[model samples]
Target: MSAAAPSAQPKLRVKNATKAYNTRSGELVAIDRCSLDVKAGEIVSIVGPSGCGKTTLLWSMSGLHKLSSGEVLLDGKPVNGPNPEIGMVFQDANLLPWRNLDANINFPFEIKGTKPDRAWIDDLLGRVGLSGFGGRFPRELSGGMQQRAALVRALSFKPSVLLMDEPFGALDAFTREEMNQLVEEIWMAAPTTIVLITHSIEEAIFLSDRIVVMSPRPGRVAAVHDVPFARPRSLEIMSTREVFDLTNVIKREIVGEQKSRYVRSSDAPVAQSAV
Candidate 1:
């Protein structure tokens, strides 16, 4: 299916974005004319090869790194730098060890010098299953728990757009799946536009409304896929023929090779819009 007409102004718009870095060897183009539009409350995932400019594109979107050319806009306004409306979560939780869970999650509020409501913070904590551990330190939490707290902390201010760079990359298989479930739950509870960068095709298919596949090195949009599944999706769906076929399509888009020994059924249509 083709991309649907956006219902409203995109929460985030990356317009012909390009980034180049000066290396000792020469000027290297990290990303070339990559563009994307993410609607409000939508979840989009980006996947590509290891050397692709996926992370660089994310940094530009977050305004952490300026684009060499093109622009990133939030709510139709140019994103020149870090905006309060945008929240970011890195691969590492990066929680302050000196502080307790409450303080760690409240760091965003503290930076703004605003006292967040105790009840609200408690509710956010509870959403991630950290209900009774507000006063506990980061050391007391597991890897998944720490990541959960990180997610809550990022959402504390009710940002319109959330940028996540492989937030569950460090976790084991079980923990990553748990985090994915937690994120989906929190997203349904409080909808926000999310742009996630991940290397795993299965993770992208399981979590995103659309998946953007990028080419290697000087990254470019190779294909865009619309996930044909309803929300409140279960892990069981991942094993379905539809999902497995879609995963292979994305893999082939990224790698340009097909290793699946099974032959494609004529009924199976590779649903993707090639760029």
Candidate 2:
């Protein structure tokens, strides 16, 4: 058969997206005038400071958090709340102790009252190198294995968009690298539009087609760099000069934003319509 047709256009698009928190006194802004576009099958990584609203932006895109003013559209339709087409992978694996790998992977379908695709699930298990681990509980597996299972659970639904918030952040350096490679493999297998939030500039450069850098506090697109590394990118690329250059560029951009730390706490939500 000829090569399969490419996935749909702009699987996840966030235009003029903004989000703020409502407290006892006034609105506390998180993301400010943030706009992003993720085409079908593209892996985009967002890098920013701790309080720069990176997680808030990802949550808004997933419709888990309400936007202060802007709109997040999935395939052109506005995402008002928790859209099933998007799957979120949080920092922690958060696997159920009572469940095995297969059960954990199938949990989403179970809760939705939708039948699990057995064949797909099996193939996914194999793809993640957890074929025989299906029957094993979370306690029995290694940390990496638990993360692998957690990832399969988020991916089993075949979401149009994958929202990842530093899923490998808690792992050791070696495990983190392994998980990054696994992420690349998983992306190649199913090709969902992916948005990853991470502090590792090297990881971002290694795994993403583009890196979107954001400023501190009032987060906005500080800069966007396009990575032109060829496909099937190896782990060796992480050690090369290319990686350092890219990391340096991103680091400089992130550091440049720190010049203005005099943020007023009373600044009521600056218009963030395009989160």
Candidate 3:
């Protein structure tokens, strides 16, 4: 038999990543020896309980936060600081109050000392349903519209990897669903590697190729699930039985971690009293 071809290297790799902070009490570990790998053009979502270091992991992947140990690599090269190939979208729109939508979207180009692509920018705005509204300021747009602009801003530079941290957490249910659909459409149109941090199990199932569930504080990867659904998924798919079951499975992982933490804390006092 002929030798099988080797697997392709991951587009992004997190090797035994550990992040910590020095506070008044001492060192605080946020993520403990967590590692992950993302293939090219893959959409991966990380879901966990609150304060489980989901944001910290995302930030480390973006090179915005320095890991206390191990390393993050993009295309096999270490990412020690912000790189043009990586783009980030935070929970807030964070658009410049004074700059109009067009200018705000072009801000990355300005920082990179490159000229903005007007045609591409127009197409992005159109795809996100903000075609002619580019000339308006952020104050003139609604929450969803502002977020659409923020998404465009991150994509304006055509980064290879996009890191999103609860980008739609502030939106209403209806709006959030719409934004999710919009994200699916955009991602289909232009396939970019994406790593998303979200608390919503349904959102993770609706948007990701795979889902990574993290444990409570000092977060570690509790479980990793490959979404069985095919691409170009619609919002109606969220109502299916398979999706419901998968959502519950992911939810149990998070809730189980929370319960374990509670048990550990509760048992500590009893053991001390027994002594």
Candidate 4:
């Protein structure tokens, strides 16, 4: 008889992670005993209401913030600090005003004391529709263009995992949609493990393999929804009945959490649904 197939291992693991801040009004818990697992080359998005500690959880996963308890592990090793294997893209482009687009994308290489791969950088620029705009400074580019450059910069080093915190939040609706399409195209061309934080349920549904919903303050994983659509998804998928039903389900979960005045900080049972 043939041997049994081995289960795929998670490229990134968050085990009982908790983060707290000592605010002026005593200690405030941001996230409590939140745990998640992301397989290699999969895109997972976290959606929740504002101040639900989604960003805090993403930051903790990136090793930008330390956890008060539990741990984030990459490749089965604890992540105590920023690892070169992880790349981040923030809401703002955060590009250097003085540096042109080409230089900005090469910044990671410089930081690592390595030479930039001109060919690869150019290919990335072309892929994102910024081929000839490399010489242009951030100020000269539109908001969408700036974000494209930022995305390229984060991917320039070819990190194993990419963490995006509402990277397209600043763009107009039309432009944001365009960027979303662009991101999907890029991911299809070269798959990467991505963990995204967003308030837009539609965005999460469009982009993620799994959607993780968090409770309000002192966030915990309230639910996890597996997206059923195949890869290379189009905007039309957003209007489908499956997408609409899934969106409503997730919205209800967030709304239910918000209505509850008292939220538990300790670990709670997480609901999982496949759609």
The digit string of per-residue lDDT tens for model 2 on 232-269 reads 79988888898888888888888767644533222434
lDDT of 4 by residue, 132-173 (tens): 897899999999999999999998888899999999888998
Question: Relative to the true structure, how large is the alpha-carbon lDDT of every model?
Answer: 0.85, 0.83, 0.90, 0.88
Taking all chains together, each candidate's TM-score versus the true structure is 0.89, 0.89, 0.94, 0.92
Candidate 2: lDDT of 14?
79
Query: What does candidate 3's lDDT look like per residue over 1-275, in tens digits?
Result: 00113487888999999998887656778999999999888899999999889999999999999999989999999999999999899898989989999889888998999988888888998899999897899999999999999999999989999999999999999999999989988898998899999978888999999999999878899999989787788888999999999998988889988888888878786522321
* Candidate 2 TM-score, C-alpha based: 0.89
User: Which ten contiguous residues of candidate 2 have the minimum total lDDT?
Assistant: 266-275
| Candidate with maximal TM-score | 3
- Judged by whole-model lDDT over C-alpha atoms, candidate 1 comes out at 0.85
Candidate 2, clashing residue pairs?
16-273, 16-274, 16-275, 17-274, 17-275, 18-272, 18-275, 70-273
Worst 10 residues of 3 by lDDT: 1-10
Question: Number of backbone collisions per candidate, in order?
Answer: 0, 8, 0, 0
